[model samples]
Target: MSTIVVDHLSKIYPVAVKEAGFKGTLTHFFKRTYRQVKAVQDVSFQIESGEVVGFLGANGAGKTTALKMLTGLIHPTSGRVEVAGHIPFQRRSTFLSKVTLVMGQKQQLIWDLPALDSFKINGAVYGISDRALNHRVGELSEMLSLQGKLTQPVRKLSLGERMKAELLAALLHEPNVLFLDEPTLGLDVNAQVAVREFLREYNQRYGATVLLTSHYMADITALCKRVLMIHQGQLIYDGSLDRLVDRFSPCREVKVEFARPYSAHELSVYGDLQDVEKQSARFLVQQEGLTGAIAKILADLQVVDLTVSDPPIEEVIGQLFQAGTVAG
Candidate 1:
């Protein structure tokens, strides 16, 4: 079953227009001019129950705006959205209880209070019984590896610990749908890995549906098999992560470490030479020609080692955004 559905979803905002002059300011004060900014335009997609999908976009690409509409934080200017069989903007009690939105840049915990206190407050708000709340907190904290840290004031915990605590609190109600925005933002490498592991485990254990948005490609690569790419507030691509890569980047990077030095010109015969440093060189070779190119290189050149890999996901997505258009 589809846990979330959106059709032709869009949000537009009006911004007051003013010129850089006293006359313009005086006129704006009495009769203002405004321009419509299309933050999101005709975006549509569906996420099945228990699916983890990545929402990809550059800054100001309406990723957050779309999330807000899906979470009942803001009403969309047009189209339709249903999460867990409920209209999100309605903000019904049953709907709210079935979904959770966690933004890394925002905190719901009281800074001066221990996170456990905040959890209790959230429990009260959700009408969870004392025993059930305690059980849920204990289970979630253990999964998050947040043992014994909830007693400290929120401000005293490390950023990673606090992020984990936030996850625990958010999951206390066991929402069936999770909308996470950069849950690993500002986390160190180890912390990022930890959070990713926790999320994977939680999803598996609860069969929760997750729609995650992050600037960190690692988060997307680690957690999502399918991704939706939004450029200029429009969804440009939606499919498996591997398909997205194959579509945008039809070539693989082949790094060859030679037994002897080779000039860039000499390496160009094998493929598109990317760079050469001492005895090693990198080339971008079309996937169709990869096997033939490797055979010729080995047969003609003194090669010590070679490795082939897809272009980094970040680079591929970056290029896609730069082009600003993808064939539908």
Candidate 2:
């Protein structure tokens, strides 16, 4: 069964006219004009249970707005949204209790209190049994390495530490569905990797359905096998991450490692060299040309090793966005 189903969902905000100053405000109180801004327009998709899907779009593309609708933080202007067999906008306690939304830029933990206290508060709100709460907290804390930091005030914890704490709080009730928006934002490289690893492990262990939205391609690449791309509130693509790459990614990048240093003129006969070093050169080759490119390079030089791979996910997404903007 599908964990989430969205049908022709749309969200529109009324833009209120703001006066320049006090005098202007008084003059325009009776003559204000309102503009309609459509944030999400006719977007629809379905996510199967236990599927890890990436929701991708550039800024102002309505990713966060859609997430809010799915989590019952906000109601949709029109259309339907169903999460875990319940209408999310209804804000039913049963549905809310089974889902969690985590935003990296937002904090649910009190700054002055320890994360443990915040977790306890959430536990109370969810009506978790004391014994189960403790066990769940212990498991999540151990998984996220929050052993010592849970007792520290949130303000005293580092960005990464606090993020881990937030994850613990969100998962304390063992939510079956998760909506993560930029959950690794502002985290250092190691911290980002740690969060990514934890998410992967958690998904595997519990078979939870997750929909993640992030500007960081690494987050999507590592956590999602399927990706949905939206542009200007329109669904543009939805399929395997590999297929997204195959359809939009420029081409495979061929890196040939040389046994010895070679000049550029010697490599140009093969393909467009993207980067070069004394003993290695990277080339951009079309999918059809990859094998031939490798063959020609080996036939021409003392090549030690060769590697071929799809263009980076970021580049693929950039191209997708660029095409979208141009089409608009």
Give all candidates' CA lDDT scores: 0.92, 0.89
Model 1 regions lying over 4 Å from their true place: 16-33, 256-308
Clashing pairs in 1: none
Tell me the RMSD of model 2 versus the true structure.
5.0
Best by lDDT: 1
Least accurate stretch of 10 residues (summed lDDT) in model 1? 319-328
Provide the lDDT at 281 for model 1: 94
- TM per prediction: 0.85, 0.81
Q: How many steric overlaps are in each model, in order? A: 0, 0
Tens-place lDDT digits, model 1, residues 211-274 = 9999889999999999998988899999999888887897898999999998888889899887
Which pairs clash (backbone N, Cα, C closer than 3 Å) in model 2? Answer: none
Model 1 — TM-score against the truth?
0.85
lDDT of 1 at 87: 97
For candidate 2, write residues 241-298 as lDDT tens digits: 8877766765788888999998888788789777789899988787777788788788
Overlapping backbone residue pairs in candidate 2 total: 0
